[model samples]
Target chain A: MISSLKIVEAAENSGIDQNIILKFILNEWVVPLNKKELTLDEEDIERIKLIRELGEEFGVNDEAIPIILHLIDQLNHLHLSFKNNYCH
Target chain B: MKNPYKILGVKETASLDEIKKAYRTLAKKHHPDLNPSNKTNEAKFKEISHAYDQIGTNEARTKFDQGEPGEENSKQQWSSFYNTQQNAGRYANSYADQFGDDEFFENLFHGAHQKRRAQNQDINYLMDLTLEEAVLGVEKVITLANGKNLKVKIPPGITSGTKLRFAGHGLTENSGPPGNAYIMINVLPKAGYIVQGHDIETELPISFMEALLGAEIEVPTLYGSVNLQIPPNVSTGSKLRIKGKGIITNTDVGSQIVKIKVVLPKKSDPELLKAIKSWNGKYDYNPRGEK
Candidate 1:
């Protein structure tokens, strides 16, 4: 787990705005490991990075972010299901 | 309403299996989640989803084929049909939760920012990675289009189609903040290795003598070379699995599968020919089992 400060630093290194990161956290787009302590895991960091990408790179609005993420989650689930069926 | 078959890119005479395959393919292609911020693709996705809902199953297809109603009366008929078949609850829930919201469509189509401020355009940056680099994450400095150098960290076990985003590194406008930069990872194919999921398959060429007489040979892996033991009398195309030598991901580790290919000497020596003739005379071996 990483602290919120570390997330901010990583975001800054990636040229993302600190405010945007905070907003994502508040919006539950980037869920923290601990709400009080505000910690994040690698998965959370990756998700935040994806959300940042969608907003900055794809110009996706805040309202559309959740919908898009949900769809992606579903797609990933489908892929995993397919892989599980054939791999083992 | 558009024809269900046409929307899914299938013929009316297509079988249920064909329709299902078509729906899955089209859904993956135009899924709003995969192609975010693209209204046209989102609309297409919605259309496909609706068409699938109309004729996905046998009963649904039968009803649709019977000509339930035209475009004018489809709205009421679809609602009633959806209400009657509770089994379609899965699709209904997803559609209603995601695309059925009026606010979502408004935001997607005609949000306040649509007319007021132009969002920054996204920048796509392509990055090539070797198999080793992909297996083990690497950090490198990348120069953006705006002449700014930024250090990027690539995660381990990244495969093709993995997109990493660098926030606020995209085009900037006077109206709002800068856009994001996406790093699309393309893992170059290795000559000897073929990656299947987390596992790696490679061909190991061995001499015929080595196959007949067991030998330990060095096999190449993602990290380095390791010695692998070959059993005596092993046939060509035999697979040897080396545990925990394939891909390393956050959750699981894969193995390396080495396929053995027995190769004979290019030129035949006189001594070898004479020895082979004597051996053949001593013992008649019918490899083909025809006798």
Candidate 2:
């Protein structure tokens, strides 16, 4: 499946504002493939959705978003490392 | 839908300032954004916001006092709480300090995208190894979180709880260097061998006849099986040392200590019983010190 999406497609697919997606990209929370072309993968779309929830639903500010995203990413990495290394 | 005054820990006759103070304190304490991993805190935050909405404004307080249900402005509660966080100066100035508040969007989109270096996060993992594998070096393939396979070589004579660090093998960042990965080793004990420091202790079971008469027998070592000589009339619990047969590390070489155990037949044979009975009176010996 073609999972790579352009910035406009990502905003339409995720129902997030284009400006907000740009902010997320600038924050480096959701890294796209080409900064100039703004090509995002599926994981980037998921991160954009999470960022939206953190803002609109949880009332998180822009300053706190990066910190929360970093912590969540660290937790996910640790869990994945454990799962992959166990019983092999 | 509990009592608003009770939930906010204020009286029905509380002033606006008092109500606002209580609501801000409770909302900040239970904010879901701050405590992201806590579901209880999120639920409590919602409840606190609901309570604040019930009697937050003077008109709402009056309506509540006049026996009317205070309108539940859920969206308004979030805005107020968010504003409260901003006004309280918790993380207000940090955003402005990082990127100028007025020109943040302009600086972000325009040619002002300056690259900044941030510290990468380090990660730790647990690894299991056999006693032999720890004594003798082995190579392992570990799959990282990024689905990359990393080959790690564990040095010989590594004990349990030894941490091996792999540089730049942790989480990767867009602007910063990747973090390091630590693999902690837990060495599982072998069935027949017990490792003591640099030495290995193993038990060898010998026949009763071998114990009575001198015999050369083969014993297992870390390197391979070797001949071990049992002296005549050897007793149980006797220890024989085999030099340089245990662990071999870079700095040190260890020996293997073999403990002897004499095994008697479970069922008694008639011929053996007869021979023992004939030799019993001639021996006239009591192993115990009792007369």
Interface RMSD of each: 18.2, 22.2
> Which candidate number maximizes DockQ?
1
What is the per-residue lDDT of model 2 for residues B132-225, given as tens digits with 9 covering 90 to 100? Answer: 7777667889998778999887656667876777788988866598888889999888899999766899999998999999799999886789
TM-score, B chain, candidate 1? 0.56
DockQ, computed on Cα atoms, for candidate 2:
0.02
Reference-based lDDT, each prediction: 0.69, 0.69
User: What DockQ values do the models have?
Assistant: 0.04, 0.02
User: By how many angstroms RMSD does model 2 differ from the true structure?
Assistant: 24.2
Q: Which digits, one per residue and each the tens of the lDDT, describe model 1 over residues B1-291?
A: 347788788989888899899999999999888978553465467668878877899988887888773442344433433342233223223445443344544564575344546668889999999988887667778999999998886655667877777778999866676789998989999899999987999999999889999899999898689999999988899999997777754334678999999998999889989999999999968879955
Q: CA RMSD for every model?
A: 17.1, 24.2
Residue A39 deviation, candidate 2, in Å? 54
**TM-score of each model, in listed order:** 0.47, 0.44
Q: Chain B alone, TM-score of each model?
A: 0.56, 0.56
